[model samples]
Target: MALKSPRFASNAALQNAARSAPPIRRGANGQHVAAIQQAFIDLGLGMAISTKKAGKADGIFGGETESRVWQFQARMGLTRDGIVGRDTMAKLDELLPTAGPPPKPLPPAKMTHKINVHMRSIDNPTVPEFTQLKVMEEIYAQYLIRVDVLTGQSVGLTPGEQFTLNIVDGDCKWDQVSDEQRLLQNSGSNQGVGVNDIVVYFATVLREKNGETLQGCAGHAPTRPAVMIAASATDKTTMAHEVCHVLLSSSFTPVHVGEDANLMCSAPMCTGQPAYLSVAQLNRVFASKLLHKL
Candidate 1:
């Protein structure tokens, strides 16, 4: 017979591991396995129903794992398809944090709209160093709202979701807390997140000469709550680019040249970096269709 998990160790110990940056794919014993028996255990989730079909203790995913994932998706208020994609991953990361339950909900899911979200916008905030970053956030936010409205799931923030910019200049300790953070901060000059409705954007020590090196970086959505991170608003173009990443993060991947519109335009159009004004201009209907399914 397969062995059951031992009892919970010190919450302090778990917190310590979390603080020291525990491994993402580990068991209660915190050792390597062919596959994770249940993800919840690693994330400090105990005795949750399995979403996969295999035996409850089976390492690989089965029906039970699927079920639990859907429940998680719903509780976290995401599009629950049972499959753990970027959106799901973002939600999980936001919720199953080793530090304990993730941060409190930023806002509640408002009216479920049947309308396709046309792009929305807010006045661009003024910032000298990260001007591009700010524009990117605004534009990016509009992009997500538009996509959610169109896809029939406006997974953006509710009203009152505030955004704060926390800059830890020369504070090496900020990156020293945990492995996950250190890993991100090591390469996170262009990352940001929507905390509840409050999107907290991050800029790292690497943002020099206005984040030109990170223009290629795109936003990512993991399984958890609706959160995202983008490049700082220091560079002139960083804001717009990062905003595009943040808004398009959940339903879309900002990278993937194949996803770009095939519109034949008189206005300048760089392969991946097109001014995303109207979806009507998008010649790639196939990509747009695929985005909704995601």
Candidate 2:
């Protein structure tokens, strides 16, 4: 879900501030944004990071950029509005000396010793970014069914289950992952020697507005399973998407390619194979939910 009201007083004020200095986009998807925030770090402005505010609907300027700028202002004791005024600019000059024209940022790392052309942008714009998250519960359930049929593992894919299930909202941020978040986010976590412990199930929505085929998206992680809805997603479809992935995750068993599980749900858009997938062929068990949805 996202905020409905315009968080800023006027788009003009936001526009003027952005024209002077554009808001830096930062996130796992937007490396350029991260690098720009790093510039603030270099400037000794307090911590500057991306907020979960969606950039597509509202605009990048008024969302994370403003949030980060406001943080900078707070650290500088300027009114905590996300506008980077002259004082903030001066502070930037004082703290971080102009590094010789911002160093070119390294591109998103990829595992390309030898490559297949099937790879796509992990950070590319996802279509239909919002839906009725309430439905993802069913998606997750169906995902579980798929996994059981595929893997034959002893986990619940039906209405009854041994483990308690929960669905919550918030980022499963590996770094800032709270005890609760740790349970939901799969990346950078402790899954046994040969277990995936997580899966991401995405449903195709075929949305007219965004031309997106996905109704919603959700993750079946080690500690918690999460549901994220795409715009206007129906209740049943949303739930089914996420449920499918959860079942998949629980069903997979790792045979060990290099040193990790054979299957991975999060597509590795990076240089490291084990970061998401394994090196060995038989040892791997990959989920094609996103692939199938696409």
- TM-score winner: 1
RMSD of 1: 20.3
TM-score of 2: 0.22
Give the per-residue lDDT of model 1 (tens digit) for 9-107.
233333333333432221233221112324454443332333223445554343334434444554567765544454554444444444343345434
lDDT of 2 by residue, 1-294 (tens): 111113221233323333445433322224333333555544433231232233222223323344445445544555544445445444443444344432333222222111011111111123322221223322222112121111111122223211211332333221133332233233222233123223332222222233433343433344544333333343333333333334344444431133211122322111111112211211121232222221
Cα lDDT for residue 171, model 1? 23
Output the worst ten-in-a-row residue range by lDDT, candidate 2.
Answer: 112-121
TM-score between model 1 and native: 0.25
Model 1, position 288, has a per-residue lDDT of 32
The best candidate by lDDT is 1
Give candidate 1 regions above 4 Å deviation: 1-195, 207-235, 250-274, 278-294
